[model samples]
Target: MSGLFSSKRLRWFAAAIVILNGVFPALWILFTSLKTENELTQKPITYWPHEPTIGNFISAFQDQPLLTFLTNSLIVAGLSTLLSLFISALAAYAIARLRLRFRGLILTAIIGVSMFPLVTLMVPLFEIMRSLGLLNSYWALVLPYTVLNLPICTLMMVSFFQDIPRDIENAAMLDGCTRISALWRIVLPLAAPGVATAAILAFVNSWDEFLLALSMNSAVAYRTLPVGIQLYQGEFAFPWPIISAALVVAIVPIVVLIVIFQEKVVSGLTSGGLKG
Candidate 1:
């Protein structure tokens, strides 16, 4: 009994440490955003703001076209997530349900492709976008984001698809449902947790992507939030408070997404673990 109690306490301590590690930075940013610039520069640092104000949040927008950046990010992330899920679903279903030649090799190739560092792809992607006349445009970001998200999304869904019984799909086929139709009406619904998980992951990746967005969409009007946020820092000086406020703003959508889809994400992860 004492040993079990000690083990439980240790697990709780580790979980608390992990949670604090992730939560502390965001909490610090929020606190900093609420502080005045004068307080930020004071001799003695303060953990909590002595004089909190909404000025930084207001200034974050006024200092840059933050709204436009927010809009661009939303459009890019949304489109990319939809495309990633659509394509990944088709590919995953084919890999999981269809007995195609070299399916295992194909999956391995996908995993290999996804493992390549984003920096290495930058030059080639930029040149491709330029040649296609896609640079400084939403498609420039969306297309690459979709491609970057595909491998993981497909692999995740494949695990979920494999977990589902073939009898369910075979019965649907007896009911005059084609494979594609069954995938739409049956397999997909059954794998809703995986779908939700993949969608959230894809959206978050696209939302947070910096290198491709910065390189491909250099135009101010086309810039995403991560790239646009840099405009807050001048060569001469950094506006820490206003930048924190913008960072806080940038964080809200992702936080909301995770909170909303958190259950599905956990379910998908747990199912994947068991499937493995």
Candidate 2:
């Protein structure tokens, strides 16, 4: 092991292997998306397309209302994350700072609830949404997404809020700031790392949720990206190129977000790793 690490050439070779393992699937998808259907199913597969084209990308947008799907996904995910963060912030503050009775039990219950199998909750959730007349609206998705993610988000926020020095909030109170104002001005700013972590988790979970999205909104006009992309199938055949292109398009927002907030995300996760 020591000799392997000491050799620069061997280390570089190992790094290249790991990188290829991670990147090759994406490269394959991109290559397949550019291929004509004939090339996709050719007897002897070609590594590169004999004829490369952007027609699949164009058709992905034209054949489906990809833009509408994107909009629905953004609205549901963004709203769910924001509301989850707001609610979790207050909940975390109460449990962490106010030192509520049975705080540990409350947090444990929250974690247990979040661990419930999504499949088990589907039937009842569908019936309730139907009864409430929310079946075909954004509320059907947002409400569940926010609820499903709340416990975990609250847990992470608790961990983060506990990490803050109580003296800081105490000092703010001494300076004539009320508890609400101090939370708004002092502790929340310090807990930005945790908030970012919770926001990312909630947003991504909501964005990628498929089963609930599929069951809640059967209307094509109300579909989110994950379920909408699956619509590339037909009665007689499936179109792989257009499907792949749609998937690539679907993931663009998440990839861009992760890239932009990489630092905040890292800091948030690490800061929320400790307990009080």
Candidate 3:
């Protein structure tokens, strides 16, 4: 009875801690975002805004093309996610299912490529994009983003596919289903969780990516939200309230995405890492 009571108390404590850690930072951001420029700069720091106003957000939007930045970010991130998932799924299925002599070699190469730091490819990638006249276009960011994410995404899909039984594929084959049909109809449906996981990860990476976006997009009209936000700060001065508001805006989409796909993300991660 004592042990059972102790376990219950421990579980409750853990739950409380998790909730507190998650809620506190978000609440703090929300609070800070509501403060005015003066209140934000005052000595002794105000915990709550005295006169909470939407002016900071208004200024942030007005000062820069926030909507344009957001639209560019969405387009780049969305397209990267879709393209990465499509290619990774096909490559992963091939690696996982095909009884080829070089299957192990191919998988090893794919995993090995992921271990290399992305910075190492910057020079070569830039030259290629320059030669192709894609340096200032969306394709410059989209193509690199897709390639950068492919290895990990493929590995994830491979693990998920491995968890599926081979008998299912064989059954489909006996029913006159081709390899492509079996992949699309049988494997894809069962691996929905893994695909969603890959898409979310690719989306987040592309959305938050700064180095490539900053280097490649030279025009103000092509700048992404991350790059545009940096322009708000100068060497000697910065607007804390407006910057905070921009940060809030940048995080909103990511928060909404996680909330909506919480279940699938958790399940995909656990199954991919542990089960397979």
The lDDT per prediction is 0.95, 0.89, 0.90
Worst 10 residues of 3 by lDDT: 24-33
lDDT of 1 by residue, 84-107 (tens): 999999999999999899998999
Task: Name the top TM-score candidate.
Answer: 1
Say which prediction, candidate 1 or candidate 3, comes out ahead on lDDT: 1
In model 3, state the lDDT of residue 127: 90
Q: Candidate 1: lDDT over CA atoms?
A: 0.95
Native-to-model Cα distance after best TM-score fit, residue 32 in candidate 2, in Å: 1.9
| Candidate order, lDDT descending | 1, 3, 2
- Expressed as tens digits, the lDDT of each residue in 1-276 for candidate 2 is 778667977889899999999789778888889999999998888988889999999999999999999999999999999889888888988998885789788988997898899999999999989999999899999988988989988888888778789899999899999998988899888888788878889999999999999999999989999999888789888999999898888778888888888888898866655443
Q: What TM-score, computed on C-alpha atoms, does each candidate reach? A: 0.97, 0.90, 0.90
Number of clashing residue pairs, candidate 2 = 0
Model 3 off-target regions past 4 Å?
1-25
Clashing pairs in 2: none
lDDT of 3 by residue, 77-131 (tens): 9999999998999999988988879988898998898887878988888998999
Give per-residue lDDT, candidate 1, residue 227: 99
